[model samples]
Every structure is written in structure tokens, then in C-alpha cells.
Target: MLYWLIKHVLLGPVLRIFFRPEIEGKENIPAEGGVLLASNHLAVSDSFFLPLMVPRRVTFPAKIEYFTEPGIKGRLKKAFFTGVGQIPIDRSGASAAQAALDTGVRLLREGNLMGIYPEGTRSPDGRLYRGKTGIARIALQAGVPVVPIAMFGTDKANPIGSKMWRPTKIRIKVGEPLDFSRYSGLDGDRFIERSITDEIMYALMELSGQEYVDMYAAKAKEQAQPLPDRLPESRAS
Candidate 1:
């Protein structure tokens, strides 16, 4: 279908030829069954490149805004995400977070590879951030293993404000799947969830060699805002 055509024929070929993305530990991904690909979010291209490299169709819960914007560009974006099987979740309201996790659990139970960023958002400074527990909740709910993946050089190719991708070498490292089968049926336990999330973040830190920031990426970005304005004072101007 459209996913196959885009990944294999249209976009895949172009990316392979130019970026020449490399992957390590490909064998770590389970050959079949419901599993979680827990990865560190480095850049927007992390989504594109990971799916292209993996054999299976990886589905991500895209923010509802991506599918609801106005104008022709918005229409195309919606169509592309829908055609490729992305699930749109409204990332607003108190119930939105649970709804997204519910969708992921259902997908995993259906034996689909669900791509999740445990950190919740892209790393603002390329350092691994403390992971949110939604990933752990989904994994425990679905009774699946969590595979840690590290993406390298994507931030350079698709930096924060770049509209176009540059030719930068890309590399992916997949770590062994972390099994929390012993914690089965304990999905809602906050302590267990935090423990599981921290373990996943540690694996990503080891794989990516990025500094592990104790704070969440979103908070770090917020704090980073004031530094820019303070830079002038530090420079004595």
C-alpha cells in the first residue's frame, strides 16, 4: 500500500542513497510479536530514519495538530501520516495522555511494533533526558519487551530550525530488549513505572554516549529560554 510504496520505492531509496544511514545490533529487534521500540528522541528525523531502517511498519502516535492544521501543507501532512498508519492523538486535556497510552497498548496487543520516545519529547540539547513513565505503562499493560535504540547524527542533519535536511551520516544502535515480565500486572504502580523508565533511559545513555540529564527535556528547554537573554549581560554588554 502507500506505506510500502513510500518506504520502499519513494522515500527509502532516496534516503539510503544520500544519507547512507547505518545500523548496529539489528538482530536485537524481535523477528515477530508485539514489542516496544523505546528510543531517545534526538531529532524529528528520528521518526523517519528509524522506520526506514526497520523491516516492520512502525506506528507512532502523532500529535493531533499534525493532522488538523489548515491549508494545503496541512492537508498533505495529514494525508501522509494517515496513509502511513500513524495514530493521531490529541495531546491536550487531562485525558489525552491516557488515551495515547491506551492506543499504544492496543497496538502492541495486536502484535505491532510501537515506536515510543520514553523521554516524551525531542532532546533540546542532544542529551538523554529523564523518561516519562508512559512507555513503562504501555509495556506493562501490553506485556511486551522494551528495546532501547539510540539515534546518532540526526540532530545535525535535521537541526532544530532547519527546513531542509543536509547530507549527514546517520547511525542507529539497537540495544537488547529489556524484559519486565516479573512486573506483570503491576502497570499502575508508580514506583514500578518510574523504575522501569529509569532503566530504559540508562540503556539509551550508554548506547548514545550522550550526557544523561536528570531533568526532563521539556523542562530543560523551558529553563534554556532565560539563558539566551542573560547572554548579553555575561558578555558585558
Candidate 2:
């Protein structure tokens, strides 16, 4: 099968030999049923590397732009992402966020393992930012447990906005699954959402050893936006 070939034959050996990622607490992942692996996003590689180490097929909802384009280039890109098992969701507006969570809920309801970046965006300074309530909403509504995952040193392994990368030690720490069963009676209420997000962030803090900020990841990203982050200045600047 292509899955095994990619995991065990190709990417598996190459990643183990080159990056030398140190994965701890993998046992925290549930062996069966629907589970969420909520983590911090530090680099683009976070998406690929995290899933590679996991034994189960961990799926994430990638932006629809990954599949949308005109021509052969677009088709090839779409096929590649599809082959890797990433679900495409239109992330355009308020509805975009909702659609991702909606899709994730459906996957959970089907007893699948879903991976999400609670911080939402890569932390600009590597410090853990506040997680969005969306993660909590997904867990509570879907009635599944969330496992806190902390990925460290990935940005250094493949720093953002760089065309070249260096081999560096990467660490992935999977904390214990968080039980939101107490909110089983609350359903989709705001109170339960906040509680779930807080618990997830706390676990990430312990694992990643980063200072925690109380603001949402998006807001933190806005504050840390680079000069090129403007219409004029950019990473190339």
C-alpha cells in the first residue's frame, strides 16, 4: 500500500536518519476511537513531521487553497495533498473556521484521530499563545477526548520563510488526554468551551516549557506580524 510505503519505506527512514526527531509520550494517544491531537504550530513542517511519527493515520483539515488552482500545477498539488490524507476545507471567513470544525466533528463522530493546532498559527517568537475556543468547542460537541501535543525546535529545524533547512533535533511531547466528560451535560455552551481550551493550553505549557500568554493565537500573530507583514515590508525585506 502507498501508505505503508510512504511511512515505512520512504519518509520513515529518511526522517529518522536526517531530522532525528525525539518523540515522547506517544502512548498518550488513544489506541482506538475518536481522539484529537491538539498542538502548537511553529513551522510549516509541523504539519508533516508530527503526523509522520504517529502510528495511526492522523488527519488534519488543510486550507482549501491547497487544492484550488488552475492548471497542471494545481492538479498535481491537489493530488499530492489528497494522497497524504489531508481533508480540504474552505478557510475564507467565519464560515471557513466553522466548516473546519464541522468537518472535524464529523470525523470524531466516526471515531477517527484528528490533529489540530490549537494555537491556530505558528507562534512568531516560539512562546505558547492562548488557544482558541474552537478547539474546546470541537472536543465538547464531538464528545471526544483531546490529547495535548507539544512540538519544540521545529522552527529551528526548518525556520519559517527560509528556502533552505538544517538538520536539528526535534522533540514531540504528547501529554495525557484531557477529559471534558464533566461538560457532557453542557453540550455546546460557551462555559464548557472555555474550560476545554484552558485545560489543553495548560497541558501544552507543561510539555513545551514555553511561557503562556492569555490572548488567542490569532491576536498574538497580529501583534507579532513582521514589517513585511504589511502590504510593503516582507520576509524578503
Candidate 3:
């Protein structure tokens, strides 16, 4: 398969040789069975590097656009992502949240590991943001343990808005699996979901040592951008 070829034969060796990626607490990841890997969103490379360093294949639900773009480049891009274990999910409409849960639950129920970014988007300034509760819901619904992970130096290796990769070393720290079975049958409770999500985020904050922001990453990005200048009223006369 292309995934095996690229990881073992093509790209994996090249990356290990240059970047020297390191991982701590690798043993925390179970050798088998289903798990939900909840990590902070840093650079786009977080998706690539985290999976690259882990022994087990980690699959994330990527935006549907990654596989739907037109033209040759798009096709190749889609192929590469799919080969790398990215699944496409439609992130539109009112049911997008449920749709994502369905996709993740199916994978977990089938005894597969699933990677998720609870922030829903990349952090704008490397500060940890409030985690979305969808991940919590998925874990509860699937009865899987949530493994909190934190990736460092990935932003420097493949920074935001950069089209090329750098040689910065990447490090990953994995926390012990969090079991929320005590809150069983409470998947539909928003309060329980929020508590679970906050607990996972706290674990990530401890691992990554990043400043915690209570707002969503997308909202923080919007707040960081300057607003457009407004025209003075011309009809005052």
C-alpha cells in the first residue's frame, strides 16, 4: 500500500534522519484496541508528525475539501492524504457535529485508533484554547479511553503559512489514558461533555506548558485580526 511505502520506504526514513523526532511516554499508547488521541492544535504538521512518530497508525477526520478539489494536483493531494490515513468528512450544515461523531464512533467501535484536535482548528498564537466537547462525546459514545497528547516544535518545523518544511526537531509527550466510565450513560449531558473536554485540555496544558485561553481557537484568531477601517458618516449635513 502507498501508506506503507511512503512511511517505511519513502518519507519516514528521510524525516527521522533530518528532524530527529522524539517521543516521551510512548508506552502510554496501547499496543492494540481502540483509543481517542486528543491533542492540541499547533501547526498543520501536527497531524503529520504525531502520527509519524507513533507506532500505531493514527487516523484523523480531515476536511472534505482535501479530497474534493479538482485537477491533477488536487487528485495527487487527495491520494497522499488518504494513503496517510486521513478520512474525509463533510464539515457543513447543522448536522456537521453529529456527522463527525458518527465517523469517529464507527472507527473506534471497529477497534481503530482515532486522532482528534479538540480545538477544532489550529491555535493562532500557540496558546492552548478551550477544547470542543465533540471529542468528549465521541469517547463516551464509543466507550474508549481518551489519550491526551501534546506535540512541541512542530510549529517551527512547518510554521503557519509556510509552504516548505524546516529541520526543527519535533517532540511529543503522551499522557496516561483518561477513563470516563464513571460518567457512563451521560454522553448526552452537555455538562458532562464539557467537564470531560476540560479535563483533557488541562492534561495537554500540563504536557505542552502552553498558556491556556478559555476561548475557542477560531474565535481567538478572529479577535487577533484587526477590524476593517470604517468610513465616517458623510450624510451628517
**TM-score of model 3 (CA atoms):** 0.97
- Which pairs clash in model 3? none
In order of appearance, the predictions have TM-scores of 0.93, 0.90, 0.97
What is the C-alpha lDDT profile of model 3 across 161-221, one tens digit per residue? Answer: 9999999988999999999999988998999999999999999999899999999999988
lDDT minimum window of 10 residues, candidate 2: 228-237
Model 1 worst lDDT window (10 residues): 228-237
For 181-216, candidate 1 gives per-residue lDDT tens digits of 999999999999999999999999998999998998
Arrange candidates by lDDT, descending: 3, 1, 2
* lDDT head-to-head 2 vs 3, winner: 3
Which residue pairs collide, candidate 2?
228-233, 228-234
